[model samples]
Target: MALAADFRHRYVTPEASLYAGEPTRCEELAELLRHILQMVDRNTPFRHGAYREIYEALHGFLHAGIGGSAKDGLVWGVKDFWAVWESICLVHVVNQNPGDILTCDMEHLPVLLSAPERRRAWLKQRALLFARNGIRRRPDLVLAGGDDIKVVDFKYYAYMRQQRRTAEADEIDKIEKDYLSMEAYGLLLQNHFLRNADARANRLSLEFWLPGAKAARQPSRQQPPWDPPLSVVHLPAEDLLRGYVALYPHLRLMR
Candidate 1:
């Protein structure tokens, strides 16, 4: 059978008319997707999340039936930007190390496992699970081996706010909370292993990573005896996307 002229005109050749309101790219892409849908209808299979996501966006915007576009009530700018930030950081870490990073109790966070060859392993031996939203339920990531473990929390703190000379009234509170939270994370991680008799390390190695410029000298670190030695690296945004490369050697990658 042949494709309809009206269908082709509206989606494939939609321009220099009232239909020009819709982007040419969306029109072209949606037309191509028509062919893909035809294949799917014939029992051909193509399992991909990207295709589905784009299809839904196009369908709603294009009204899913004939050729008319709707842009009202369609918005960007997510309120859960923190969730997106968390996922991106996880992607960077997994992509950087490939097969080195270990995740525990991440059934709730599939973004980390979205890639087929992410090279990350699900930690089953003494894995830790918590009660809360997906982001809060577990540490962002952990690197562990024979007797060394590093629990990394991708705390998207507003570092620039605190780095300024004139701190905001809440800056001190944020700093103190961030510091103490890392301490608590250390203890939680330490006990998490000890309880299951699966102590991967003699003690927990706590580290929280922040997004910022690489420091000329060490930014800061605490080494109190009672608490696990807490260290942090302010990874540059540029380096984070590059998967921790161009980052400081201290950004330990355990494989």
Candidate 2:
């Protein structure tokens, strides 16, 4: 009770309050945040890290407002959404802790990261120190723990939709490209990263997370036809579509 009263007194007070211009809770909270940031001392190392985490939390909160509409603060265009998928996958890791391998029977695919490791932090689009054709390789998601560096590339492969059409030469070409890219990611990390020198290729575990039919059987080992210790994780199309609808409810229900 005292705390609540103190908060109201500090933040909600207005001596000559104008009835026509009362401050919204959102604006008031933002003002409070500005005050907090101004007061925070960034000189101390430990406190600086903690302050940084708090800033990220605030940024995330403001990135999307209370209402889930267009007017609700910052939003992204849906041109290329693999980045969004990468974020969602990271959430699954942070929330569910899928460990190194996913269970055969699971709604969400397991993440290559472990619980303690996931809690530390998951990175996004960190540029690898390798480049081909003057373009540096930046994987979608990355996590490092001890001798292991786990990397995941989210594929908006659209297999569920693509299955309707017959495979053609171009499709084969695309698949080959994707596999080769995954292989390159493993190699790039091994070259610069010195932890697992003996088994350079095996040091980093890379996987392409793709959407697939529930009827499709989960392979005990890696998903197939390609060889290179590459892995494939099949997330349910129904759930993925459901997630899309949750984010944008305009599209008709998936047939």
**Highest TM-score: which candidate?**
1
Q: How many pairs of residues collide in each model?
A: 0, 0
**Per-residue CA lDDT of candidate 2, range 1-255, in tens?**
998578668666554232123446445555565565455534444656767776755554434233244321222323234444554554455444444322111112222223434333322223334455576665555555555666666776655221212345545566666655667766666665554355534556766677566624332253343333455667775675555435323221221
Question: What residue pairs are clashing in model 1?
Answer: none
TM-score of each: 0.46, 0.40
Estimate the overall C-alpha local distance difference test score of candidate 2. 0.48
Ten contiguous residues minimizing lDDT sum, candidate 1? 70-79
Instruction: Evaluate model 1: give its lDDT.
Output: 0.50
Model 2 per-residue lDDT at 1? 100
Model 2 residue 163 lDDT? 21
Put down candidate 1 lDDT per residue, 124-162, tens digits, no spaces. 432343332343545667776446777776666645122
Model 1 lDDT, residue 54, Cα: 57
Regions of model 2 farther than 4 Å from truth: 1-84, 97-125, 128-134, 145-147, 160-172, 194-201, 213-228, 237-255
